[model samples]
Target: SQQGEEDPQALSIQEGENATMNCSYKTSINNLQWYRQNSGRGLVHLILIRSNEREKHSGRLRVTLDTSKKSSSLLITASRAADTASYFCATDGLNNNAGNMLTFGGGTRLMVKP
Candidate 1:
């Protein structure tokens, strides 16, 4: 089954500020990943947290997963105008895990002003 819902469809912040997004999924997920998209172009993977992982961080990016709540969150710090883009959360689970079918969240649009 398909699952994953992102909160706050849109957000606006200053260049030096920070942006945070949340995601919720319905099924049992093996892992959760965060991606960033510039304009309307392709997406770039930011971070991935396994179901067993509670939190992970990469540079300015931080991700947290709570299987108990079937939810996850992504945080981007020290934002820049170049960071303006859309973010998405993807879940890998069941018959649709990894190389199989991929389910993604609705996505959150972030606008960072210089």
Candidate 2:
């Protein structure tokens, strides 16, 4: 079963602004991964935060994970037109073979205006 669900089916923002996306899951997860996909393209791994970590940063992206709340958020600072894409949150359950099993959320469509 899919464990994560992203809030705000869509988002629109101006360039240079910040975009934040949230995801909530139903099960305990070992780690959460965020991905970005351009229109009709494959997903690109953005960042991954383990259950033991609260926050992680990669370039212009910041991710936070709260195991207690079963939620995660992704923040993209200084948004650009190129940042327009669909963002997805994936979670790996706490099972022994969970590493190979990733459940993905529906995703949030972000439109960054130039």
Candidate 3:
């Protein structure tokens, strides 16, 4: 089984600043996914890039992948107060008993102050 690990469990940034977070995985994966949780709410899928892709961008979110290193990074540009939430990365592997499942990291809590 594979699991995701994130660094700097928490972060604080100004409304207009950029927020960056990193995630590492313990095993090979088919794809990596980034999600955001608004306080006590369920996670919302932020982005999903395949293993072969290097970088992906969606609005203010940018994700980078390094398959050789088994690591990924998420960058949130021009933050806003609404962006304050817990971000997590999930690892997806093909060989699994439960079909397509995601192993989530502890998460990085981001606080965007106005």
Cα lDDT tens digits, model 1, 14-54, are 99998999999998878998888898599998888998999
- CA RMSD per model (angstroms): 1.8, 1.2, 1.3
Cand. 3 Cα-lDDT: 0.93
**Candidate 1: regions farther than 4 A off:** 95-99
Query: What TM-score do all the candidates reach, one by one?
Result: 0.92, 0.95, 0.95
Ordered from best to worst lDDT, the candidate numbers read: 2, 3, 1
The lDDT for every candidate, in the order shown, is: 0.88, 0.93, 0.93
RMSD of 1: 1.8
Per-residue CA lDDT of model 3 for 1-114, tens digit only, reads 338888779999999999999999988889999999999899999999899999999999999999999999999999999999999999887665785788899999999999
Model 2 lDDT tens row, 1-114: 558999888999999999999999998888999999999999999998999999999999999999999999999999999999999999988873636588999999999999
What TM-score does candidate 3 reach? 0.95
TM-score of 1: 0.92
Q: Rank candidates by TM-score, best first.
A: 2, 3, 1
**lDDT comparing candidate 2 with the true structure:** 0.93
Residue pairs in clash, model 3: none
